[model samples]
Target: MENSVIKFHHCEKDIYCFFVPEQCPVCGESLSSRRLQEAPVSIPSPFVNGQKIKCSFLVKPTKGTFLREYDGRSDLHVGITNTKGVVYNYNETGVCRDEQGWAQSVSVPLVQPDMYSLINQWDPYLEQFSLAEMWNPQRYNETDHNCYTYALTFINCVLATQGKRNLTKTEFTEKFVLPRTKKASRYITLYQEISENYFYIVDSSQQEDDNSSI
Candidate 1:
């Protein structure tokens, strides 16, 4: 990412690989210094003690990451956060996923920070989970019984306390997880190409007619 170049696709229309070009790649519009940079990105606050971001489930790479801004398959680890931003994730050995290492984690905001803090029962339910299936490490299986199961179980527990219906894996993944991951994957691939070439361009018209995830 030298000079941090990333190609800017203009709203799924034409290709615009303006490395500060003199004119706009489309419409033959003139370029200005300020507009050429696009808009600057605002970084969010850190996850620690950030109730809004951490009140829901969080996902990060299982091991050291690379541009893994997010992805929820085998390479990713999921966790639930307390109102105070303490993450509780499960693994084969134990439930201290954070004790390992993480560069960054993207959170899913299914659970609300205010809702969790408003209930006096929330903390108790979290503590009680320690006595559940995770109590026996032998039950751990990377594919079947894993961190995702633990997090989803806690979500259902909270729903029960709130008198809401349970959520299935299909709905949770297709509705929530995939949307966020697509954005991350697109960002990563775009960056990878730009880092090498210092510029990238895409034209929707040039692409084949097909359905594909980022």
Candidate 2:
């Protein structure tokens, strides 16, 4: 079955990668508008000094829009533009509305480390599958893996959400999956099991006592 969620991968430079199709592959009909079926939510990383990011969910294009348009399109035309212009194939400019309002413009961001890639939606199945391939440093390419593309996509989303209150674990799971859980777990297993490696809790009371002692 097709994904009910309109997938968006975060990237650097304030860009989100979304899938959009131009015409029906089966019937070849022009597709119409799309809408987010679920509210946008985010996962926060505790290690990164607190960061909140959005999730992926179902999208309902205006009635009459064919599902085929979104199926095989590589153009990234994912969301409806504020101008309401016709959503183009492979278009990244249109598909970003985080449950608040339509966004006007979009751009992709630059991510470093180049190892762990992230997706907005968490698929338990993907974890196992991706692990099978594992991240081969030699095989890394921006054009190849969906992991890189989506990680790049979400990096932009993270940059967009910076300066906001970090999301709680509940918020993170409800919204997006923690990036690089599988591989990182091998290195940081202790951190993952306890807090999902999302946040670092600070004891304010202890800090005050320590200050008094000093």
Candidate 3:
């Protein structure tokens, strides 16, 4: 499959292409080389041991009228990704409605070095919290139980592991509220602040200082 080549159909023209697999292993859909074409990509398995892992907070836009008109937000989805590059979010399957659709729109990396360690440590806790419901489509709710809440919960877990304070509901709203709402400016500002504070790489010296103090 790795050596196979694919030809793209673009504007009624066939173009030679290479590198990508001929078909998706999971969905068995034909792969296309066209820039506009969307196809599913495989997610690599998670690392088995406590190796260095990077997690990113992601936001994906929604195209549904019900989502936009009713929710009043273009930022429809939120999720997290590890170094293996698999996104974990709460949403319906095929939410993107495209072959290659997954949270590819916007992303911000977590700042802490022990992010993966915390994830491994919190596995049992998450399970008890009904982590399986995250994958259940029927359990999704727009207000009380949504992708935003899922992401915020995960972030809070990570923060707890670091001895950091948890974000309140109001604070979470201010930081990640839908951009189309009346608090657009405040949302933008708080989003920038959280992104910069929680997503950037920490200095080695600072990290050492933190660890030593702890």
In TM-score terms, which candidate is top? 1
> Per-residue lDDT tens digits of candidate 3, residues 66-164?
212224345466665545545556765512112234422344456556555665654354444435545467767777777777777877877886789
Clashing pairs in 1: none
lDDT of 2 by residue, 1-214 (tens): 1122122111111111123335422234554444322322232221210012122221222222222222222333222111112211111221222333212112111223331333322233223323333233344443653333333333344445444454443554344433332222222232332233232222345535665211
Clashes of each: 0, 26, 1
Answer with 1 or 3, whichever has the higher TM-score: 1
The residue ranges of model 1 lying beyond 4 angstroms of the native Cα positions read 1-52, 66-74, 97-100, 113-121, 203-214
Task: Please give the range of 10 consecutive residues that has the lowest summed lDDT in model 1.
Answer: 41-50
lDDT per residue for candidate 1 within 1-214, as digits (tens), equals 1123323334453332325455555655675645543442222222222233445677677774435333334488888766556677788876652533433555677555466353545555676785675546888899988989888888887788778999998888788777776666565565556555544555555543543323
**Which residue pairs clash in candidate 3?**
39-100
Candidate 1 overall Cα lDDT vs. reference? Answer: 0.59
Point out the worst 10-residue segment of candidate 2 by lDDT. Answer: 8-17
lDDT of each: 0.59, 0.28, 0.46
TM-score to native of every candidate shown:
0.68, 0.16, 0.42
Model 2 scores a TM of 0.16
lDDT top scorer = 1
